[model samples]
Target: MAQSDTVVRILDTAEALFAEKGFAETSLRAITSRAKVNLAAVNYHFGSKKALIQAVFARYLDPFCEEFNQELAILEKKSEVSLEELLEVLARCTISVPATKGSLSVFMRLLGLAYTQAQGHMRRYLQEHYGQTFLRFTNLLKLSSADLPDAERFWRIHFMLGAVVFTMSSLDALRDIALSDYDEKTRIADLVARLLPVVTAAMQAPVPEQPELVKQ
Candidate 1:
């Protein structure tokens, strides 16, 4: 196999394993076995287990960050963009992946693992590559919801991320139950459409005032 093909095979196997077993549980041996690549190849292609994990995340995040940043750049050029528009862009980023990339569900599971696992390395790596894109996202959120206090905006952004991660990661279980229990077809695309409004509402929610305390 070509060197590039070998690298991709390793990465593809690692991504699936990590998504299924998580960063801590999945081992290099398991990955090598699944990828049909020898230990020497894995060591040659990726120096260590940590580096392999980072590569697995990069496989999904690089494309997502690239597409999101491109859309964000265009949106910024507009005279004005609604909060819903911004939310839709974020929603579309995850949902559209399945159509364009065959690994949407797996990628989402990996993303959820990123949040739950010790992701400092992966997060910092992506940040180094996509810091400006994230900064732009924060700035856009500030502009779109000018009324929100800085603290509120920060927390809400985290909230939005949590929702996105949970929604995407849980889709499989949810879809299964829906199919067995209700016989209804709950697709990722449909869920994304429903999620947009909830995320927008969360982002645009009014900042609550600190309540006055009565003497106890």
Candidate 2:
């Protein structure tokens, strides 16, 4: 195989295995075996397991961040961007990014694992590489909800990510249920359409008053 083909094969195998088994659980040997390449190839291309994991995410996120940043730039040119518009742009850009078949669920599953799994290196790597895009998105979110306190906004942003990760990670299962139980065929776009309003409403919910602590 050509060097580029070798790298692509390794990445594709690594991505699927990582999504299925998580970064910590999936071994480099397993990835090499699945990709039909030797251990040397993996080391040559990615150097280490952590780097391999980062490479897997880069395939998906690089394009996503590029599209997201462009959309945010366009929105920034407007007088003001509404909370709903910001979220809609996010959804559109996410869905519009070109990905291989069945890779969307894989991408979301790996994302969920990134948060749920205890991989400090992966977290730090993501922060170092993609933190700027995340910060820009968070800044826009803050601006859109200027009325909310900073602490509240922080929690809401995490809550939104939690909802997205949970829902998209189980997308295939949800689609199966929708088709079987309701006799409805749902596309990813349709699911995002249903999800955006709920996410927006949750983000826009009134801040609850803090209750006084009772004496022990």
Candidate 3:
């Protein structure tokens, strides 16, 4: 294989391993062995273990982020669309290719890793990459629910995303008990349509907080 092909194979092997088994559990030797490359080749291609993991994410995340941002732009350009339309677009962006469980699951597993790892790199990535977009999303929510305060808006954004991630990651289990007519391929649109109302309604009203009493 060409050197570039070797690098790609290493990343593919690493992404699956790291996603399923996690970074600490997945070793460089295991990755090289699976990719049929040598330890030196892994270093030459990626330089280090961290670089490889980041490359694995970049392989999937960068494209999805660009596509989702472009889709958001197009949605905004369209005249006076409903909140539900926006929600549906957000949901559909996730499963761009239903057949490729590799991409979507990889992302969720990466997210799981970031959550547990709690490293500076993941923190920086979230703050710089995802957090900026997250703030932009807050502005969009403002368009629909202009009255909400900053704190509420922030949590609501997290709430909607939590809904999307959990649901998308677990769609198959939900489908098994679902009506016979339902299939992930055919019914995702319908599924998003149904979810939009509940999500939008939840965001529409002012989020209430429990009263804070001073502890002596």
Lowest summed-lDDT stretch of 10 residues in model 1? 94-103
- Against the true structure, candidate 3 reaches a TM-score of 0.77
lDDT of 2 by residue, 1-216 (tens): 334999999999999998887787889889989999999998988898988889889888988999999988888788888999999999898888888877888898898888889988888989999999988888888889999999999899989988988888888999999999999999999999999999999999999997899999
Q: Model 2 residue 183 lDDT?
A: 100
lDDT of 1 at 139: 86
Rank order (by lDDT, best first): 2, 1, 3
- Model 3 lDDT vs. the true structure? 0.70
Clash number for candidate 2: 0
Name the lDDT of candidate 2.
0.89
lDDT, model 1, position 46: 88
TM-score of each: 0.87, 0.94, 0.77
Candidate 3's residue-wise lDDT over 79-160, tens digit each? Answer: 5656676676666665573335445646665766766674568667667766755555555657766678877877887787
Residue range 1-91, candidate 1, lDDT tens digits: 2349899889888987888888889998999999998999989988999899877766666777888998999999998888988878877
Candidate 1: misplaced stretches above 4 Å? Answer: 1-3, 98-102, 211-216
Q: Considering TM-score, where higher is better, how would the candidates rank from best to worst?
A: 2, 1, 3
Task: List per-candidate RMSD values in Å.
Answer: 3.1, 2.0, 3.8
Error of 2 at 51 (Å): 0.6
